[model samples]
Target: MKKQDTLSPYIHFDRKDWAELRSSTPLTIDEDDIKELKGLNDELNIEEIVDIYLPISRLLHLHASATRELYESRNVFLQTNVKKVPYIIGIAGSVAVGKSTMARVLKALISKWPNHPKVDLLTTDGFLYPNEVLKERGLMEKKGFPESYDIAELLHILSDLKSGKGRVEAPVYSHITYNIVPSRTQVINRPDILIVEGINVLQPPKNGGGKEIDQISVSDFFDFSIYVDADEKTIFQWYIERFKLLRGTAFRNPQSYFKKYAHISDEEAFQVAESIWNRINKVNLRENILPTRHRADLILRKGEHHFVESIKMRKI
Candidate 1:
């Protein structure tokens, strides 16, 4: 199937003609402009980003500003209505497609904006079901799948934030141990901007009657959303590289759950990685993740080398 015809929220980029499609909004930021958040690497430095991400940062700022005005107008129209607060942005992508890095970068950039100086970042990993629950359900292999997360908790938290609730507490996940530790909730107090980045944040609410209770989806709380997109082949390569890097770093820690994978041979590691990808991540991507691509406000399409080569914006 052609890239654009896919129903996913992301638009895939092949080596065609995209140079002319680069944004012409004249929104650019150099390294000196945002020295707060550490760049992922020298390759992701501001000079390499100004032409690509700067305009995106500006677009997000504009969207946030407009959303604030919209709420104010509605609040005025309904005299009894308290102001709906906090512009929420959801960032979704595969595990190693650099969504976390993008979210952190945006958090830093957006917080610097005068309109919303109190931006916060949250990850859905924190909401995953406890290890005991997963084991009881025989779903250890489906860890990153939507079923692995505590959907009820996630939904409730998002609902509270959308209703302008103050001082929301979210649990923290340890990447080193790959588990939800205890009592480590992060408090987000009256944030102007909330960026929720997760693998399945865009999944639709389950339908049907009877035992299933209908509820609002997490995507319903988003004012704007971004999907970091790239080809599956490229993402696989990136994931393998990331896994290899983590082995020497986080995976070697005594408290890490993936310690078993730390000492595997390169060939064995590749097999394990491919096994996890093919059976788990790829299934989630094809079934749940990719189908939600069209839901994104902006799709940042990356090239073979992992740099965002083009962007597709949903028509207003």
Candidate 2:
């Protein structure tokens, strides 16, 4: 493993050094709150929250404060009292690598600051194309890939949010149904802070028709972004474990799209999980997700048991 100082464009801190930075930041979240925030099969604990996530929340608060000051300054220069837009944060990582858990934890912690900014959490899963559309396009097997998302709609939603459009509506997705709920929507008012979490949140714009045209991606609106990272072997193991766990829980539900897996034996389930990882999730991670890690403002590198081993923050 490379030493902390050896990383370029980022200042790295090991677990101890990072924990020491959590000065005076009260751990506002309790055990019950943590239970509600953690994802299924995730190894998050209160100790990890106090040591790893508290300092991150403080840093995010500082960044949000700085952004507000800049916005005020710009408004003054323009001599117009424009409404301040929300500060957007993006979180990206591989499947089963715990990005959703980090996003929920950060949202909880950040909302407890003295300013008490109204924070909203959004996941890009809702922006994925409906199952019918994917099946019609013969892309059902590539569900989590970048192309499977309604990128234009996602861009429009983020663009509207950043432009101070109040009461914007986003589609709602159901894990059990494995599709968008047609009549359901999540209304996001003008929040002071918005956290968008997804696998492809850090992806850059792709070229179009061999023409060089300026394009804005969903990430372009992000004020700060984080990438949750871990070794591929660790992620693979976690993904398989989560698959098995879900089979015994969510997949057993009659409404679950994955209900077919519920009847499989543990050995059969393992084989199916391994096949999906090798065929879909692993390929998506290598070709789409991992390449964008360097674009993040901060990277949380996790070790065994999903504990944050080190943190890397990009230097200003």
Candidate 3:
């Protein structure tokens, strides 16, 4: 264990120490279940889940339990029935850093708890502006950048969810088509738990007209948030690997927007992938995503092999 420095709000733990905190948390997921939860080219297994994620699930369960108690207490004091709002959890990270896999695993594990049996997973990819809009705005090449998202609509949905809306709908995005699917929507019912995952979920509100309004950012609605961290060099490697894997799989589909890459040679594909990463994703990570990491309630730091090495959790 590393010694904590004074004035730091985070308590740090190495992987071995963190795994011991699992205590009596049971592993509810099996091998077959993990296969369905893992992202493309991601390395995940039962051991990692038991050591890394089981403890997280337990922590979330505790948080959710406490929140419900608090809400009930408030209602009793007011002597009125108040609607129970969903507990929102945000997962943010650089592209190809496995935020999607983490979100999926948490959704499955946390939903199994008796207290919050209803869980829903939502990704911000669906909230990105349609390709036509991006092209019209001349932001087609900056797809993953914060400016490429429909920020106002995303805020409206979160606000509605937090206000205890019975039903809310979000647009559906398709990687094969590389655009928002026409007329398709994901219906979010009133769930006990909601996981919102994306690269820019933690971004601070931008100042409009040289003045800051008292408006709430998307992250302000979150009861808990996590940031997945990895070195820039290693993440670049994972991005390239995922691109190659997709070329052999999803990109080969005739309807896929990236189908053109499937016909290219390995060398050509690598060059293209590298170019895209250097020109777009890398810049977005450094300038936007990485800067917001410190705002997370929990930070899962990964090592070279895509395994989590340590965790830094906010103590206050």
Candidate 4:
């Protein structure tokens, strides 16, 4: 645990106590639905949902409702008509820490609330510079690193989204091709809630610039945020396992970007995956992702088994 964890401006909760906070929150999704929501090699149990996710979902529901009311009240006070934009929620974490699964599950739960709030999910993988750009910059080996993303473009999209812009288009990233899909875009119109999930979403702006400089970051637009956490060993194991699993699955596809590894034996796949993880993902996590954990509104700390055993929430 970090030193700041025990300090003020935050409230710590064990899993049991947190689960009680769920009290009357209904379980809207079933086991069958969760199966589809889980990421490859990720674990998602109904009990985990009832314990951890439900409470957070309920909390977000209340927050969103309150935010909407405040927005309406401000409009009335000013005696002017203003467009209400969607409440943006940011989710940040390291690779293979079950963050994608958390985002999907949260979307499923939050979208099923009483009013059935319209929820849209946007992953920042699309905001990564196109493959060619990475190659041009000689950063293919640092693909998930902070410097690899198109930060300016990401901030522009967030600015547009927060200003109640209609029909903002986001680039689409393809896993099979490991590149941005040309001519394809995911148009995001206004919704009740928008979940922006990525590894670097919580990063601070004005990197290396003096404190005097004014800057904007994508996180500035978030109404709420979450950081998924797990030990390095656990995440490393998960990543390697995911790579091995994909060898027999996604990697085998003829058009797969990793098709070259599809026929590699288990030992070879493990070694390659380990090398990639040690070189790229680990460094990115240590240098960029993990440092932003303290900036999240909430942190979901997972045990080795991939279940969140505790949560740390910043005081509202």
Candidate 5:
């Protein structure tokens, strides 16, 4: 029981009432028309997305339009400011927490909007340091950890995009290889809206004035940010289930880096999956990842079934 004089604001959105808060503006694209997204951890069907994500996309479309008008006005205000880049949106969350699904959902929904219909989705997995660098630094166990990434390169990409660099290239990662493939890159050419999603995209800036001072995080370039929220147990279960699924699917491919897991029995696979989660992913999630949740503009909280049950937006 605290005093009523506290200035802290209380705001909440009910899962049952999500429909009530939806923008009256009709959805230009039918949810049924949107393709189903297949992710390792979750299956987001068209209906679930239309009810939950379509409205959110509608909001973002409005946001992008308003932002463009403001940017044009500012550009005119400063004749010397010649180039204005795409509005960058950052989505961050723990492993197997459905951030990737959110990115896919938003990308599909936003692309249908009449304004800035061209939407591009990019993942920070491309920004990771090569496997050789991780092995050399003995950081193979800390792969998803912040230090495992080439922050400098990631920053350069974001900076270039924000500065209206018409042609941008991002490294491409092959899930089967579990590594960044050299000479294979994704091209982004003058995209109207860009979505950058990752686990540690929102990590705080480094304080040291060395090589890190110039390293701008993906979050620094984002105009809007979202952080998906869920309890540790739920996310842990999701991670395990996802790992099991991959063992039979992607892990069975001869070219897969995890192909070794295919030989293990179900019990052995489960143990191996839990071992990796306990050692690497869980540590990073609890220490370096979850701490950044407060930095998001909007937080989407999910329940045990992996369904988003509530939303918390930082009070303006």
Candidate 6:
């Protein structure tokens, strides 16, 4: 077992203890929903939902309720009427650590709440600079790094949503093409909640790469944030496993950007996946993603079998 973080500000909970917190939070989902919500190569059983994600849904719902009450109180004090914005949730983690799966699960669970039936999820991949733009900036190798994203645009979209914009558009990204689709966009109307998932959503201002920086940041818009974490070695193995699965599936598509990998021998696939992870994904995790883990409002630490072994919630 990994040693506890002695000086950490978070109140930690073991799986069994955390499971106890799910008291009376109705089990709104079942195995069928789990099979749909989980991502490729990820695991999600009914117990995990009852123990881990149910408590999480309960917490987020409570927080959102409190926030709405506070907003209404402010209106009473100021004697002015303003709209209540959607509660934004930021999910951050290294590649292949199962953050995406958790995001989907949370969105599904939270939407089951009566007051927050309309939930929307948006991933930051669409905010990445298009392949052409990255090629021009010589940042194709740094695709998931902070510098490779259009931070300004992401910030604008979040700002608009927070200001209660009725409709906002985010670009569409195609994993098959491995690039942003120029002609398509996702239109987000008013939602009771929004889940924004990405590797670096919790990142502080870089104040580098010749970019503009200020007191405000992407995370500032988040009412609650989560970081999915595991040991680097564990994450690396998961990445390789997911890559192999993709090679057999998505890579076989003629339009896949990685089609060449589809026919490669198993040994060759391992080497290529290893090289990509080492050169790009691992470096990004070490330097950019993992460093922001402490900034999260909660941390979900997964064990070797890809199950959340423990949780750490920031103390109030």
Strongest candidate by TM-score: 3
Q: Residue 292 of candidate 5: its Cα lDDT?
A: 94
lDDT of 4 by residue, 202-297 (tens): 988865665432366779999999999999999999999999999988998899999999989999999999999989999999999999999999
Q: Candidate 5: which stretches are off by over 4 Å?
A: 1-10, 25-35, 211-215
N/CA/C clash count, model 1: 6
Name the runs in model 1 displaced over 4 angstroms.
Answer: 1-43, 81-84, 209-213
lDDT to native, each model: 0.76, 0.91, 0.91, 0.89, 0.80, 0.91
Give the TM-score comparing model 2 with the true structure, all chains together.
Answer: 0.96
What would the per-residue lDDT of candidate 3 be over residues 1-316, giving only the tens digit for each residue? Answer: 6447578878898888888888899888899999999999888998899889988988888888899899899889999787879999999999999999999999999977765489999999998999999999999889989889987888888888888788999999999999999999999999889999999999988856453333557899899999999999999999999999999899999999999899788889899999999999999999999999999999999987888999998886
Q: Measured by C-alpha RMSD in angstroms, how accurate is candidate 3?
A: 1.5
- Work out the TM-score per prediction: 0.87, 0.96, 0.96, 0.95, 0.92, 0.96
Candidate 4 local distance difference test against the native: 0.89
> What TM-score does candidate 4 reach?
0.95
Residue 160 displacement in candidate 6 (angstroms): 0.8
Over 200-262, each residue of candidate 6 has an lDDT whose tens digit, in order, gives 999887565464545558999999999999999999899989888998899999999999999
Clashes of each: 6, 0, 0, 0, 0, 0
Residues 1-316, model 1: lDDT tens digits: 1256456544444323333333553333456554544333213665435556656677787787788888888888987576457789999988788788788778766766655478889899999987888999988889888889887787788778888788789888888777898878988887888899998888877776243434567898899988888898988888777777667777789999889998888888888888888988888888888888778888887777767777777756
Q: How much lDDT does candidate 6 score?
A: 0.91
Q: How accurate is candidate 2 locally (lDDT)?
A: 0.91
Checking candidate 2 for backbone clashes, the offending pairs are: none
- Model 4 clash pairs are none
